[model samples]
Target: MHSIPKHMPTSTVVSASRGRSAQEDPWWVRWTLISLSVLVLSVLVILPIANVFYHAFSNGVAAYWNNLTGDRETLHAIQLTLFVVPIAVCANVIFGVAAAWAITRFRFPGRTILTTMIDLPFAISPVVAGLMFVLLFGAKGYFGPWLQQHNIQILNAWPAIALVTTFVTLPFVARELIPVMEAIGSEEEIAAISLGANGWQMFWRVTIPNIKWGLLYGVILCNARAMGEFGAVYVVCGRVIGKTETMPIRVNTLFEGGTSETYSSSFAVASLLTMLSLVTLFIKIALEHKTQADLKEAAQTHQTE
Candidate 1:
């Protein structure tokens, strides 16, 4: 039998015998923390959403429906959001996959610079990101004269809206994919190549399945931001109602117009946005749980192998 070392604290020895049970917080402390979190979420998130639905339908269903459907501008804003989100999501997905593949699979000069460039959009203010496009495409901008001479319209146009939305949402997919790709490594990719699989086939068979969840996670985040983007889109849109207005802009327009139904219309449109956020939250939570399960399964598989 060995004695406890003289340097070892008596408290530490007692705690070691008690194991992890010794470190557990008192039940009241844990319950207090749980109560605080619930209270905060109820006040901040749940209450606001409930209020949006309340204000939205207070005047009745027809009034709410008319606010969304009767106004041509509101309809157009909806259409515009529908148009921009898909295109931006597709573009980002393509760029994200390519960039992640290259960055994770290759070692090269300027690799760090390239990664930094990918993250620049996230670091910059959305307003500043929108301004960069304006300075590039505005009438007095560098290519503005040439564009005008060519009769090309970008500023205050759908293209400008898409461009700014894309800029503001650039990092989501790439950020999601990089770590997954890094973890999966190139072992399977090398094996596929040796077995005569083409690059596309290798990606389809080996890479995609490994990273599909991550890709989906990224796409979800990218889509949420693309649809919800306001600041960058606001600057680039010139707030041309019915033409360039997105859902967020439409909500702002209604609130600021100061009519009898202004509050109703704004909140009604805002209710649509709030619904979108709630849907996004649900999807994100589901994906997070799925990802955790996948990670756990993969770890277990690795250990077995």
Candidate 2:
């Protein structure tokens, strides 16, 4: 019989392996990576926002205030944004919940196709999406004659703006909820139904409570995108100054004015959008923390049970 080599001590072998595998990186390499990350962040994110605020107030506080509140065009733009964002967000919430529920809980033909189609907005360009709407609703479009015959306007109007905003933001809520719903599974819902609850009762009493954080997360993201959308809105809004201009469109119009005052005004309006984004970011972070805490608590409860 062949003699086997003696085994090394477990502690010695483990220590040798750890020494080889887990040695700390040279100090300079670590610092270089951290410095590079900070530099890129400053260049890409921090500087642009700071520049916007600087130019926004360059003409002084009075000018900034006047640009935001006193300017008729800016006010109209803000009003249009307010009107469109809510409609888009509300519509998406209903569609999102339904899509997520159908997808996560049921098996059906073309389900894969449906899920793929939900991601179409992300795959397609927003500008192209806007152009598609324009082709469908513009004067030479297929429905154009019918629309014109009825004296109904769709393109170059708020309706077109609302439609495009809804289209672009369509995926946000559904995308956010799909993974969340899948992770949660349907056990609670099945149990609720077995306990004598109806469909609506189970959804409202059980499913909604479970997915509330994820739903809120989706809504916040959807709202942010709806408010800040520029490419599609710009294409369809026709930049009709005070009439159809949203905030982003208004910024473009002001910058195109080619004057120092207009430049300041453009930055002023941009500052508002930036502030909205920052507020959304804050809410998103808080929701994430809440979600993690809830998940941990649920895990503990499950283990105990």
By how many angstroms RMSD does model 1 differ from the true structure?
Answer: 4.6
Error of 2 at 136 (Å): 1.2
The estimated TM-scores of all candidates read 0.90, 0.90
After superposing all C-alphas onto the true structure, candidate 2 shows an RMSD in angstroms of 5.0
Question: Residue by residue across 144-206, what tens digits does model 2's lDDT show?
Answer: 999999999999999999999999999999998897777677878899999999999998999
Model 2 lDDT, residue 122, Cα: 86
Q: Which stretches of candidate 2 lie above 4 Å from their native place? A: 1-23, 294-305
TM-score of predicted model 2? 0.90
**Candidate 1 lDDT, tens digit per residue, 107-180?**
99999999999999999999999899999999999889999999999999999999988888889999999977
Best-fitting candidate, scored by lDDT: 2
lDDT of 1 at 173: 96
